[model samples]
Target: MNERMTKQPKAIQAIIFDLDGVLTDTAWYHYRAWKALADELAVPFTEQDNEQLKGVDRLNSLRWIAQKGGLALSTAEEARLMAQKNAHYLELIQHMSPADLYPGVQPLFAAIKAKGWKIGLASASKNAAFVLDRLGIAGDFNYVADANQVQNSKPDPEVFLLAASGLGVAPAHCIGVEDAVAGIEAICAAGMRPVGIGEPARLVQASLVVPQIAALSIAQLQALA
Candidate 1:
């Protein structure tokens, strides 16, 4: 584990989290869903394609698929394809429950709540509710801002900003936790500090990066505020 420290400060008012890779090991679910759709359309898609779509919303992923397949899809067609992919993902995640919650997630969430910070889910997935329900952590968050609410996704800051606005917190007082480089960029652009949960080298723009939430503590996080 890598260790770097920030000076401690007053308690944070709110915390926003990215759902997929950060809160659950479902990034591969998205990758497989996209790949299945590509196969159905006879389009070539590699892991690199999925990587490019990281932190992008489902509609954008469907648009990318249409673009790469050279298939001109009308808005209706695009929506249909997106619906198909989400159905597949939902089925695949049907067995997921609180048992699938990442190591240390429950404890960390309880700790933060005890400290009086409002929690919010800020995911790029249009199926954010589905995943949250699967993990059985839906009740932990005061607000959830999924792809449906944002006009622009990560690397654009709209999603994160929306989450903060919905939580009635200033962006500067909110700390965004994410796992993708694009997510880190969005958090920074929203004028919030970002704590990245993945390989530190993969999260270059994060204010602080840790291997996982397991490595973070309430005190350590408060320091970033």
Candidate 2:
């Protein structure tokens, strides 16, 4: 087990969230978009392929799909495919309004904010702003670090660190909530507490693990800080 897993802190001043699996159910949307592009290109991909792309930026995700299928796409081809995928994603997301907010997300955001702790978003997706805006929760965050703003993605700690810096908070005073192994690793690398939103066994490196956002309470967060 990682050292963070051995103990939980009792106070936190900031909370950074991963946008895809943690904040919304849009992971499936991304999966479908990528899968469709793979099929159109005559590339083989499965749900398992989607797993490898988790927490990676869109361009990286497309490149992974092509590489895994032994397809060498030219820069132009790659751009076209990425554009196609984004178009499909935008259409799919149009149906998502504030009413589509995930279970416990609203209450969790409100509860945390009420405690006067800063809130930030750290996502691998460049379209994070659009997603959050469509969900009507864009204003909830005080800072956002998306793929376009960072040179490195998850497992590099750039995005998380950027969010911490943007929020004017030290990494040690922040808690990162993520659902991917890469995201957890990034949070740890940034020297912040990590809360995994999945099976605890799967997130054995996280300082705290919850099955879902609903499982986290303001009091529990305070106690863990």
Candidate 3:
């Protein structure tokens, strides 16, 4: 865990979500793309190392891979590798369908809607909109903010702030869910409640942590809020 549990406020007028892990398991696709590129660059990549890339931008992820291999590339080379990795990722996601959405996602969204709260996305993936479209849930969100829409990346809170702004909700009236440490930090920095969708040890920064999205319930959310 990167942090201890923290205090938070009440009320959730909107729920902001991270795309890759929270909405679906596209993190695996990301890992495969990065791993393939790492092999071509002779960089040692592992699942453990892939954890570090979660909620990070493509160019930064490539830079980390390059640093691992002790290689310093020109700007043109970096661009080539980033493009190659994105191509692989796009190919992998071509197989995605509505069934690719994680369990309980729709249910949770329904519950949030039933409660009259808004839904928003605050992901670091530039392909967040594309992925949501592939999953056939693009119309479900009231707002979506991703890497392409933000000047800064995870741990900066820019995307979350943007999402809250787009949802027309105050930060304290929103709940941000994520599965990455950096993402949890961003949620906290955004002044929103953080609900982690992973092991508590790996996401202690969140006040409300669950083993999976399926473990979430309207009752639990109500209590948290």
Largest TM-score belongs to which candidate? 3
Candidate 2: misplaced stretches above 4 Å?
1-11
Clashing pairs in 2: 9-224, 9-225, 10-224, 10-225, 11-225
Positional deviation of 100 in candidate 2, in angstroms?
Answer: 1.8
Query: Top lDDT: which candidate number?
Result: 3
What are the lDDT figures for the candidates, one per model? 0.87, 0.89, 0.91
Scanning candidate 1 in windows of ten residues, the lowest lDDT window is 1-10
TM-score ranking from best candidate downward:
3, 2, 1
Question: Per-residue lDDT for 122-215 in model 2, tens only?
Answer: 9999899999998999999999999989999899999999999999999999999999999999999999988999988878899788888878
> Any runs in candidate 3 off by more than 4 Å, and if so which?
1-10
- TM-score on alpha carbons, each prediction: 0.89, 0.92, 0.94
Ten-residue region with minimum lDDT total, candidate 2: 4-13
What lDDT tens digits, residue by residue, belong to model 1 across residues 1-225? 334435445458999999987788887787888899999999999888888887988877888888888898988888888889988988888888887778999899999899989999888888889889988899999999988887888889998888999899999889999988899999999999899998888899887888987888898888896
lDDT of 3 by residue, 8-82 (tens): 546679989998889899878899999999999888899989989988899889889898899999999999989
Better of 1 and 3 by lDDT: 3
Clashes of each: 0, 5, 0
In model 3, where is the ten-residue run with the lowest total lDDT? 1-10
